[model samples]
Target: MMILVFERVIVSLDLENGLYQEFSHPLYDYEPANRITLGVLRDCLCTFSSSEKFSDVWIMKEYGNVESWTKLLCVPQMGGCGCYIYTKPLYISEDDQVLTYFFKMGKFSLAVYDSIHDTLKIPAIQNNIHDLVPEAYLPEIYFESLISHFSQD
Candidate 1:
């Protein structure tokens, strides 16, 4: 039972007095795939965070501010029935701390951030894995998205 609390991270742009807008959030009452809304906002940079984990999370410009940015369109490997390959890589913003946790649980887990070193190529993780986190843990993707939704304000 992995969980993902999408944090509202502000990407610091090269522009002066840069501010962050809502990055990722929870998709309550939406389709299964919509459970998590993960992506990079174009045209700006700032910090983002979810209250559930790594409260101080931020997504700084890894390279430099461009005319546009990317947002990873990712989901648990098990839930990629409708995911597009073109947008898959973008979904994984290494700066997204939320992915660091859930991906530790399953094979299709963690499209971006990785907790265990050498965990690069999606290792085989069984669905509903509990070895990493406690049994009563919150669903990784949803929780993280929800948290990101809440704190982005």
Candidate 2:
């Protein structure tokens, strides 16, 4: 299984045989302020998010191969808009064209990352969300809305 340790290091493990191995880690000097999230797509496809203005989406083509970590796409932070501090890949489109994510910037928002066009789209939500306060994971101060729950399945 894939594991993200200390929120910055990614590792793989074998629970049954009590085996584990080091895998990958971020190369940049990280601050707790930035949102860095990891997720597993359908069929154990792995993805990583570099939650920033010029954000990066990384995918693991080969499950346990560190060399297979590929950059799926780069999402430019919209003009003066809040960055996605938290993100989760919901599902890939049936046609394999669009990817939907439960992304949070200042408030919980939805981002549809289209692979065919290499673009990110935020869908309109019907709820009246409150203005969100930012919270940074980096040592420096920053602000954004916080998400409380996520499903394991």
Candidate 3:
């Protein structure tokens, strides 16, 4: 299994035998090690890195292969939203649209990024709670289970 350690190095661990080896990607060379965020996209290991000017998303097309790392998306840091202090990719639609969560300057928002056209869109969401604090809210993806809740006899 692939795991990201504190120093921004990717480590492969063999849980069955308790052995692990560390590896580094060239993408980590240019960016600050602490700013890199590791995640999974399309069932593959992925990473998100950001700078003051842009944010990049990378996917490892083949597991355990350093050369298989491919840049999936690069989003420019645009106006209004300001530079993203934090970015988390939540989902990717069939049309190559990426649903991402971003937090900046005490506000959190969701944006849909179209890789085909290189565009970003913020969807309109209705907020019912007037006392909601942005810092108190955290967004996450929910996976539905196929197994029924009833006990098997």
Candidate 4:
């Protein structure tokens, strides 16, 4: 099994024997290594890259195969403002809409991209209490716990 690690380059770490090897692809070579963010989309290792005008999402269809890398989607920068620094994919729905979190001009928000229509939708999320807003947000996939929190004793 390969565990993806992001260092100066993408590395595959072998857990059993503790070996490290770089994961390389011709498509990834064009961008600076630091600009690439490793993630898992649809259970496959994926990379997110943002340029001045667009953000790209790439996925490796087959694990440990460099040739399996495929460009999944290219999302244009919202509003053509050129202020977005990063766009990270959070989830993909069964209907093929992609949910992404983006940072622009020091603020972070979520947007959904429809691949079928090539449209980006920024939904309004609000927190009524000003003090509850976080300075930064890191989204992750989480499962609801079935076990009760109350002590049995």
Number of the top candidate by TM-score?
Answer: 3
Candidate 4 on 54-125: residue-level lDDT in tens? 778888887778789999877777766433655588887777788987775556667788888977777776
lDDT score, candidate 1, position 35: 24
Residue 137 alpha-carbon offset, candidate 4, angstroms: 2.6
lDDT by residue (1-153, candidate 2, tens digit) is 998656445655665557876767434333424466666544444444544455555666766677777765555555444534435455556544434444354455556666677666776655334233333221111222121245477
Model 4 regions lying over 4 Å from their true place: 1-8, 26-33, 80-83, 126-134, 142-153
State the C-alpha lDDT per candidate. Answer: 0.32, 0.51, 0.71, 0.70
Order the candidates by TM-score, highest first. 3, 4, 2, 1
Model 3 CA deviation exceeding 4 Å by range:
1-7, 81-83, 127-131, 142-153
Tens digit of lDDT per residue, candidate 1, span 1-153?
999875433243323346544333322222333223233332223222222212122222442433234332222333332212212222234453233433332322333434333123433557644455543453332222211223354
Candidate 3 on 1-153: residue-level lDDT in tens?
Answer: 999765557877765569987756646426554667777777777788877777777888877677889987776676555636547788877787888877656677888888898777877789812127776666766654222356698
Q: 3 or 4, which is superior by TM-score?
A: 3
For residue 132, model 3's alpha carbon misses the true position, in angstroms, by 1.0
**TM-score attained by model 3:** 0.73
Query: Which one wins by TM-score: 1 or 4?
Result: 4
Q: Using alpha carbons, what is the TM-score of model 4?
A: 0.72
